[model samples]
Target: MEIHPLHPTFGAEITGVDIGRPIDDDTFARIRQAFEEHALLLFRDQDLDDEKQVAFSERFGPLEKTFSQNPAGGTLFARQSNLDIKTGETIPIEDARMVYQRANMLWHTDSSFKRVPSLCSLLSARIVPPEGGNTDFADMRAAYDALPDATRQRLEGLAAEHSIAHSRAQVDPNLLSDYQKSIEAPPVKQLMVRANPVTGRKALFIGAHCSHVVGWPEEEGKRFVRHLMETAITPDICYSHQWREGDIVVWDNRSVLHKATPYDSKKYKRLMQRTTVAGDQPTVMQ
Candidate 1:
């Protein structure tokens, strides 16, 4: 497999490999190394069913079982689409399902609210919209590197609280049903800076799921995190992927933040399946 840089600094488009089938140890090692170095990898023109996708994703680590807030909750897959999971019919724009999906429009890292966070997320496009529906990714390692010396030093030991409820509430206050709220993962603290276990590269860990810095005053922490988010999500370090059918992209949840762009869901059908790899350990203990 050959890897080509998709962005000047981080994301890459990997070619000459078929992820739909089992891969040997040597090839998988190179793929994992590429993932550690690049943070994001895209493979095109590959057909993958759910079984195949899960098989390939397991090569990374253990798959995360989605939580109660999503339609795909309790399953290994986090379904992204406008159609009903069972009926397969278009959902209304104002429906709770659509509101839940709107949360995806905000820039966030996958499963950061979990105690262990996530290692990476692999999303496969089974169907694509005719226009719009792009996915944008920002390189957090580059973002961290670009910070001024004083600011970098100040952030060295800081920890932030992350929660799924906090992020979903940003989109809609009433989005989560009572049952969902009852089962939601409580807020957990994560180090504001994370270092890759393999490559030893450091990255800032702020995103939508991050509510506030752990010990700071509430509003002050929010304001500070917003400022850091602004610094990290700038266009200079971002790459937008306009997906095609049979495309699969894997992004490091530990080192990058991604968001879904708008699309005309009323006029088209789009289905994307995502599987998240659980992080090996917590960045910080509660």
Candidate 2:
């Protein structure tokens, strides 16, 4: 198999490997190594069904079950589609379902509010619209490396509050239903810097899920978080992926932040399934 760099800093495209079939141990090892070094791996043109997607994702670790708020709850898959699940028809722009999807456009890591955050996420493209609907990823490792010495030193040992409701509230305060709010993950404290166990690389962990710094004044904390976000998304630190049918994208949630872009769901259909690999252990604070 040949691996090609998709971006100067972070992503790689693996060609000549079909994930639908079983892979040997040595091949899987190389893939894992590439993942650690690149932070994102894309395998194109592999027709992955739910079963195949689960099998490939399991190679990384045990999968995370969808939460109560997800339409695919009780399963390992988190469904993303514009069609109404029961009717299989295009949902109107004003529908609550569409509003629910708007929250995804915000930059954030998957499952960051959990006590044990996600290790990585794998998303498979089942159907693609004619235009738009791309996924953009920011390399946190690069962001951390670019910080001034004083800023980097100050970031160490810092902790921030993270919550599911906090991120969703960015799009609309009432987007989450009252019952859904009851089921939301309570705010959890997480270090601003995380060290990758396998690579020993440090990355900034701040994102939309971050409500504020644990001990700082509330307004100051928001400004700090916003500044870090703005700095991290500078052009050289990001890579945007345009989905094609049968593309399986795996991104390390520990090392990158991602957001979805707009698509004309009113005119066309789009479907994507995601499987998250649970972080067996909590992040190591720097």
Candidate 3:
């Protein structure tokens, strides 16, 4: 397989290997290495169904079972679509499901609220809208490298709090029920900076789910988190992907932030399936 860089610093497109089918050990090893070097990898014109996608995703690690907040619930897949799963009819715009989807437009890393967080996420586009629903990714490693010496030093030895409820509340105050908030996904702490085990590249771990720093005063910590997000998401470090059918994008949750762009859900159809690879260990012991 040949790997071609898609962005100046962080993304690449891999060709000459079909992920729909099983790959040999050597090929999979190279793919894993590419994923570590480049925070994002894109594969185009590939056919993959749920079974195939799950199989390929497990090759990296054990998958995270989706939480009850999503329609898919206890399943391995986190479904992103405008249609109702069972009937396949368009969901009304006022529905809570659509409102939940709006939170995704905010820049965040996947599964950061979980105790184990996530190693990576694989999203496959089964159906694409005619226009407008792109995914934007920011290179946190590059962003960390660009930070001033003092900011980098400040980030070290600090941990931040993360929660799914924290991010969803930004869209609507009652977006998540008490059970969903306290049971399915509760607040957890993660290191403010993370270093890749393979490459030893450190990246800032702040995102929407990151509510505040563990020990700082609430408002102060929130302001600091916002500042870090603004610093990391500048245009130069960002790459936007306009997806096509049969396209699968794999991104590292530890060193990257991604958000969904707006699409006209009322006029078109879109379905994307995501499988998350569970992180092997926590960033810091709670």
lDDT of 3: 0.93
Error of 3 at 192 (Å): 1.0
For model 1, residues 1-286, the per-residue Cα lDDT tens digits are: 8989999989888899999988999999999999999999999999899999999999999999997657787899998999899999999989887888899999999999898999999999998999999999999999999989988998989999998888999988787766655466878899999999888999999899998889999999998899998776778899999999999999999999999999999999999999999999999978
Candidate 2 segments whose C-alpha is farther than 4 A from its true place? 177-179, 182-184, 284-286
| Tens digit of per-residue lDDT, candidate 3, span 1-286 | 9999999989999999999999999999999999999989999999999999999999999999987777687999999999899999999888988888899999999999998889999999999998999999999999999999999999989999999999999999898999989988889999989999999999888888998889999999999998888776789999999999999999999999999999999999999999999999988888
What lDDT does the true structure give each of the candidates? 0.92, 0.88, 0.93
Error of 3 at 8 (Å): 0.4
Residue 220 in candidate 3, Cα distance off native in Å = 1.1
Query: 1 or 2: which has the higher lDDT?
Result: 1
TM-score of each model, in listed order: 0.97, 0.95, 0.99
The TM-score measured for candidate 3 stands at 0.99
Weakest 10 consecutive residues of candidate 3 by summed lDDT:
65-74
Clashing pairs in 1: none
Native-to-model Cα distance after best TM-score fit, residue 108 in candidate 3, in Å: 0.4
RMSD of 1: 1.1
Q: How many pairs collide in each candidate, listed in order? A: 0, 0, 0
Off by over 4 Å in 1: 177-179
